[model samples]
Target: MSQQLIQGNEACARGALAAGCTFFAGYPISPSSEIAELLARELPPRGSVFIQMEDEIASMGAVLGASLGGRRAMTATSGPGFTLMQEHLGYASLAEIPCVVVDVMRGGPSTGLPTSPAQGDVMQARWGSHGDRATIALAPGNVQEVYSLTIEAFRLAETLRTPVAVLYDEVIGHMREGVVLHEPTPEELGRRTAPRAAFSPTFLPYEPDENGVAMLPDFGRGYRFHVTGLMHDERGYPTSDHVKVAELLERLERKVEPAVAAVPPERYRLEDASVVLVAYGIVARTARAAVDLLRREGIRAGLLRTRLLWPLPAPALTEVSSSAELVVVAEMNRGQWALEVERLAGGKTVLAPYLKAGGSVITAEELAGHVRRLAREGVAVS
Candidate 1:
């Protein structure tokens, strides 16, 4: 492992390169711009291609095209740029294109705050695209985790043959920390399997084997295959048949969610605690500190840090919330992930929310104080 002090955006760029990403097409946006800039500098030396697109939409489109052409591709953006890429993001999901998207979040809902940090894009990352689809999103709490999770995002995208998002707030994105970045093990790297029997007429582009992922041959690899955003059958052509549409939709979900159980949530002091805190991304660092301070103050407070935010890691969340008396969810947005946590908890525990917006962060002192007051107010533990 080589040790160096780097920002989260820098780490994400390095991680993508380490994961064998060969093509990048992205627009420059605040906080996320560094990721694109670093890739532009690093990828070329590694024999990779990096281009600054006309906009986020074109960036996403170019990424999908490159992925189809057999390159590990990615793009990075912030609030406005992410919003612009939503339609293409949906297309990638529907087509099952393997790519990674990095969103270094700033305050949102029409360029709320450009340089400040906020976790306002949680729900947008999951459901910004239209129609029914499943997305895998990962949030890293610290600089080192930013590196590791960026690599994991690429690996998951390849393994599931779908787009995976890596979300970080501006605070973490620009914050520099000492990290010893290590290379992925052979198993950690994604293996691109060649399509069986190239040029065979019997080949089905959307026909999933046991893995529920279609065996798609790269473009120009002797495989004449069709790719489209419209609902299609197993041959990859657009179709209006209800059964074919249902099958394709079902496979999209089946291929993504079931396999996500392997990605577990990060926990701290939750084995035996009356109060639990839920947080992710940069906010999670403060939550952890608050938990430690609460424990020292004789408050049985624990933390459940969500690294994998998309599938919601329901089983793990349910188990933890059911054991705690009060579950407090903290985010930079007003109850985005908190709402999801409440729905997942399903009345198993009391859900409380701590939200901040307009680019301000929730501090450890503030979180600890809230927990102490909540505990003192006698909010029945169990």
Candidate 2:
């Protein structure tokens, strides 16, 4: 465990290598191109494979192919590119393929800011694929967390056999800082227990257990099976029947959700403050600094930095929401996570957003100013 200064995006690339990633395929895009560049140079020489795909769509399809080939694979992209990959993300979900996706989110609807930072994809990462599936999006505020969280992303993807999103804003992605890369203990490493039939001459391609997770045969393992963008049965065969579709989709979602509570949650300055603040991604880092700034100025405030964005950290939220004088939710989007909190909220908690879609980073000073105003108005922090 040694400390080295690295950009957040580059840290993610190295983290991928450490997490046993053997394949990299992506179309280069702004703010995230460093990752592609780093992987391209490093992976091939190390016996891993890297390819720059023609586009984001093919980039994702290639990920599926690689993962099925028994490689821990990944892809990196910003907003526009992520949008193009959404269709295939849904396919990975329906087919229950395992892969990690690093979405260093930038501003967006179209060609929003190419180089600027924004948390606009918070909601998209979870609900983007045109269905009710929940996504595991890990938002990191700093470069160090970017590397550590990415390794966890890969483990979670393999654990539940779902595509996990390592979501970060451009601030974290572009910022340079010392990252102490992890050296996971043998016990901590979560290697996929590849089926023994892998060495057998013949095997069931989609053989599943009681957990509904099937043992996938990697592409070159001589285990041939069909995969598709359409809903598939456990056998990976296409199905048009409504019952089969519903069953497959439900299993796909539950294979993750039932135990999502075990996912890590980061609780910051929110221990005793009546008015709690909540934010994620790079925005959460700003929110924390604002918390400290407001405290020194005599505003009793705290923060709940959301690391696990998908499960919403419901119990922890309800606990804080019940006691706070008011709570403020901020993000790059228009109250998406705030809406989730509002539903679970148990008090007179108020929602305030220093929200913006202009493809810029929300500064600690900007958030502090809002806290000062709230403190002055006595508007309530519960």
Candidate 3:
């Protein structure tokens, strides 16, 4: 292990290189621009390809194309650019292209703040793309996790044959921390599943294995198949047949279900607590501190910090919520993910939200104050 102080965005770039990513295409965007900049400086030296595209849409298109050509590819951007890439995100989901997307979140909805931090993109990461599709989004609370989760994002993308997103706020993206950067072992660096049988005219490029991921052959690898944003059949050809379309969508979702366990939530001091706080990304650090403050004040507070955003870690959430009398969902947004927690929360637990926006992070003192008020007044904290 090599220990050094590094910024979160720089750690993400190094993680991608460690994961064997050989291609990158992205547009310059605040907070996330460092990721693209670092990759540009490092990739070419390692014989990898890096390009600054015209825009986010073109960047995503180039990434998908590179992945199809058998290169481990990725791109990085912020809220505005992320919005532009939604169309390609949907296409990648339906087409089963393996790539990584890093979203270093800044204030949003329309270039609200470039240098400030906010978690406004939480819901967008999962639902920005149209239609019913599964999403794999990882949230790292610190610089070390930024490195680890970035590598995990690429691993999941390859094994599941889908795009995986790495999300963090501007604070996390730019903050520097001491971390031991470890190289991934061969097994840790997962490989995409390739076609098992010899390629022939009868080959089915979209046919799934028992794991539900298709054996997609790389382009120029003597395997030819159709690729489109429309619903596709087992042979990778466009198919509007109702049964095939329905099955395709269902399989797309079902295949990624294993991610729930593969990337489980971090349960902290939840073994026997009456108050539980839920948070992720940079807010999670503050929330954890609030838990300690509450515990010291005789509040029996615990925290559930999720590393994986999508596929929601429902069971873990429900189990913790069931045992708690109060569940506080703290975030750096206008109650985006809190809505999901409210839906999954146990019927017996009282849920409260501590939300902040306008490019400010939820501070530990502020969160603890809100929880103190909520615990005493039994009213929701606005």
Candidate 4:
């Protein structure tokens, strides 16, 4: 490992290469374009392919196709571009293609801010794709975590044979930090296990092998199969039968839920604290600073920083919720994770939110003050 000052987007691009990514397809978007720009220069000399697609949709589609063709593939975009990629995101989910999508989130409903920081896309990262489907999203607080989590995102995509989204705020994406980026070992690279070419007529394309996930066959590998956006059967054909649709849905959920459970929770100073602060991404960095300030002020405050966002780190958050008198969710968005903690806490504890949106990053002092006021008056900052 070598310590170097690197920006998060550059780290993400390097992480993709370390994960054995062979294809990059994306349109340049702010706060994320660096990932594309870096990869564009790095990949070709690496015996990999880099493509600038016409739009986000095409970029995503090309990435899915690349993955299906047995290449580890990825695409990067921001809020507006992420919105445009949702349809293909849905397609990747239903088709069971393995790819990684990086969303360096900015302020948004649409074009809210192009060059500023915001964590407003938490819910969108999970449910932006139209139907009921399972998704994996990872958020990293700093450049180092961004590098590691980007590798983890690709690993999860290949291991679970599903598309995984890496969510980071604009602040983290553009900011530089000192990072030790170790080269991945062969095992750590996590290349997909290629399935044997199905030459027999009886080969079932989508039939799962006990893990609730089907082995993905490389394109042109003599495997005959259909890939579509519709609800598919074990053979990958479009199926509208109620029973088949229900079964497919359950299988998809089963494949993803276990991976979420297997991700280790990250806890800080929560072992003996009464007030627990919960956060993720760059916002979590501020929340950590606030925890230190609160402890210095003689308040028993701790932090539950979650890197995995889609699964919501419910068990860990709920554990903290159960022990704490109050749980404060600090974010760059207006109460996205706060609402989730409220639902998971379920009357066990009071949930407070310190939220900011539209490119405003919440300050450490503001969060510490919120914790102090809550401890003194038993109230959330409004």
TM-score to true structure, per model: 0.97, 0.91, 0.98, 0.96
Listed per candidate, the RMSD to the true structure in angstroms reads 1.3, 2.6, 1.7, 1.9
Per-residue lDDT tens digits for candidate 2, residues 145-228, read 888778878887886777888888888888999999887654344655455565443455455656666666556655667777
Clash number by candidate, in order: 0, 10, 0, 0
* Candidates' C-alpha lDDT: 0.87, 0.78, 0.90, 0.85
Model 4, TM vs. native: 0.96
Candidate 4 overall lDDT versus native? 0.85
Residue 187's C-alpha lDDT in candidate 4? 56
State how far residue 124 of model 1 sits from its true place (Å): 0.6
Top model number, TM-score: 3
CA lDDT of 252 in candidate 1?
Answer: 83
- Give the TM-score comparing model 2 with the true structure, all chains together: 0.91
Q: Clashing residue pairs, candidate 4?
A: none
Q: List pairs with backbone clashes in candidate 2.
A: 68-218, 68-219, 69-218, 69-219, 275-381, 324-382, 325-381, 325-382, 326-381, 326-382
Model 3 ranges with Cα > 4 A deviation? 378-382
Q: What TM-score would you give candidate 1 relative to the actual structure?
A: 0.97
Please estimate how well model 3 matches the true structure, expressed as its whole-model Cα lDDT. Answer: 0.90
Q: What lDDT does candidate 2 reach at residue 355?
A: 72
Q: Write the per-residue lDDT of candidate 4 for residues 103-206, one digit (tens) a residue.
A: 99988878888889988888888888898868999988899999988888888888788899999988899899998888877656665545555457766677
